[model samples]
Target chain A: MKRFTAICLFLLSVVALATPAFALRISIVPDHGNPASPQMGDRLRFHTAIQNDGNAAQEGVLAWISLVETDSGKEQPVDLEDWSAHKAVVSAALLPGQTVESIWPMRLIKAGSYRVVVSAMSRSGETLTASPFVDFTVRQKPVVESSRIVPVALSAPLLIAGLLIWRLRENRARA
Target chain B: MNAVAVIARKEAGDLLRSPRGLSWLLAMAAALSAFSLLLISDAELSLLDNAEAVYGMCAVIMGLGALLAIVMGVDTVAGEKERGSLVPLLIAPVARDRILFGKLAGIAMVWAAMYLLALPYLWAAGGAGQNLAEGLVSLALLGTPVVLGFGFLAMGMGARLGSTRSALMVCLVILLLAASPVILGPSLRQTAVGRIFDWINPLSVALNALDAVIIDSQAVVSQWLHWNLTLLFSGITLWFARDGFYRTAL
Candidate 1:
């Protein structure tokens, strides 16, 4: 009976020792959960939720969205200054079992395959957590835009020049 | 017909159909075309926000219009004096004030035409995304008075100097001073002296109002102070121009 009691105590101690001191869980999704189609100059919104599963309150945790272009052999980090004005959100204090949600809006400036993720760092700077990468493709906008602009650009000056010539000739004839 | 109307019509026809005036308009169109094409086709420039592109076009249009105004204003009395036609104009049935009003009207007509010419380019750049219409309205509201203010100031100087070359030189110097805000960086514009200068500078006021309306998406009702500055500038110039005409020697 003493051995049985010792075994029960040992099992309980192992379970407590294996458990993490603090748990920070995060998940990110595009606005509609489908990142199938995006284009240059399109505004894309992302929704991220951060939840604290630990026993103590969380404070001073920093969360930000990161974007990386993953176009085959050309992988690089995208600068978010033009894409978004506000990129980071800091929580003053998050109680245990409480969840915080944030929305990030970005304007796509280039066309390429990209992966975006949300990362969070703990207040004590010990633990770092990141959500799963959300992969998406941003297609190049059509060339029709240039074609549409060319006619106006060409014709406006020509029309003015024509008017000027005609007016000049008319004035000479009158004189 | 009123003396003002008669002189205004003749002056408008004379300048609008003149070779030099048409050359100015043609130059403006060419510059606008080049800019619009670059904005649409260039990979990097195309990435700018649609509203920002519109604001750029607005600034360009305003600058071109002001240049044309200065040219025409300096030519109003001073050009005629150089050609030995001022005496005949002064001895005509029109009062001096009516002649000034007539000249102002003629400049207004050219300015209106220039404004109309800028519309298609504005639409091409900004019609797709946002704030194109608001930018246009704000431009007209701010651009008209600011442009006319420069015109009247140039005319007054032309009357006082009685030499188109001298007036043109002085007006160009003043224009450079007015446009200095464009050369200064954003941080520098926030300093005490810069703030005071921008508040009084009609061109800066117009550009700021355009930025607020187009980029910041602020409502036009919030831009009353900017409007007041442009109007005050115009009023002062008109008064100066009237006094200039009264003191001029035929």
Candidate 2:
């Protein structure tokens, strides 16, 4: 009888000691900085921080960059071409209430308004019940381009002058 | 119905039916096209991808508008005299001043046509810009008056000269005079003459207004002084052109 009670107590203790995987609370801080308007084809860097606020240590976490649907405002599937970093990140013993910083460097491939989402998830497909996401938007670059104006400004006068000079010479020759 | 309307329609018809008019249309079509300019850069092409590129197109419009005022004004009075087409029109019951009005109205039609040709390019060039619609509006508000000033000046010179060659020379001189301030280096633009010219020159005024509207997105009130000066210059030049045309009509 004493053995039975000891076994029951031990099982209860063991059950109580192990935290359910769903109990881990993870969150990310949204960070958007300068050059929010990026030119097309420009390499861009994004910085974010993830925190594990629950009782369990989050392991084999990967920071993913995703495109948010412009109209639907929903996250698209992670794309390699659209993002910079694709590797899973393991936190250094990020126990309960510990934090980790992450970076995502990407190149802008197309020109249009874009909203990007940064999500941190556990590597083991089923362990994490919740994930953290950081969202931000950037506008197309070269909105105020003026380089092409230089040649036109200079050449317009020269072309007009040349035409007038030639016409003047033609008239003199005729006379 | 009215003499001005009648004459304007005839003039428009004449231009629309002629080879020179078709050529001008084609040139304007090509000039306002962004595809050619976009090809020059080989960047991913979008309507508003390179907003600054459209300014080159605008500059072309302004230059062509000036050239049109000058070249067409050669047909306004001096070319008519050279071709002996003026005497028959002078005998009509229309007032000599009305004849001048007809000419002005005809030029206005041509400008309106040019503006229509340019509208698509404006959309493609600076569609994403702040206050882009206002920048487009500046064409009507500021561009028209600038063209009027040059048109009237050209007509006045053409009336007095009554010969295409001399009038064209004078037009060239006027073009140089107006464009000189533009050709002046930035260092020169800081001087007193440049400052004064910047304030008064119609082309500068128009361009600055567009820059303020499209690029800077400022309120129209800030450009009021420059716009006012442009309109005033236009009115004065038109009045002078009418006087010259009246005297030269007989």
Task: Give me the runs in candidate 2 sitting further than 4 Å from their true place.
Answer: A1-175, B34-51, B181-187
List the per-model TM-score of the A chain: 0.70, 0.49
Clashing residue pairs in candidate 1 are none
Query: Per-residue lDDT for B58 in model 2?
Result: 64
Interface RMSD of each: 3.8, 10.2
Chain A of model 1 scored by TM-score: 0.70
Q: Pick the candidate with the highest lDDT.
A: 1
What is the lDDT, from 0 to 100, of the residue B33 in candidate 1? 94
* Model 2 chain B lDDT-worst window of ten: B39-48
Model 1: how far is A134 from its true place, Å?
10
**Which CAPRI tier for candidate 2?**
incorrect
List DockQ, one per candidate, in order: 0.23, 0.06
TM-score of each: 0.69, 0.58
lDDT by residue for model 1 over A1-175, one digit each (tens)?
A: 9999999999987765444334678888889744458788777898999998776677888899889999989899988877777699999888889899999888888789989998987665465788899888888863225655678789999988998999889989999
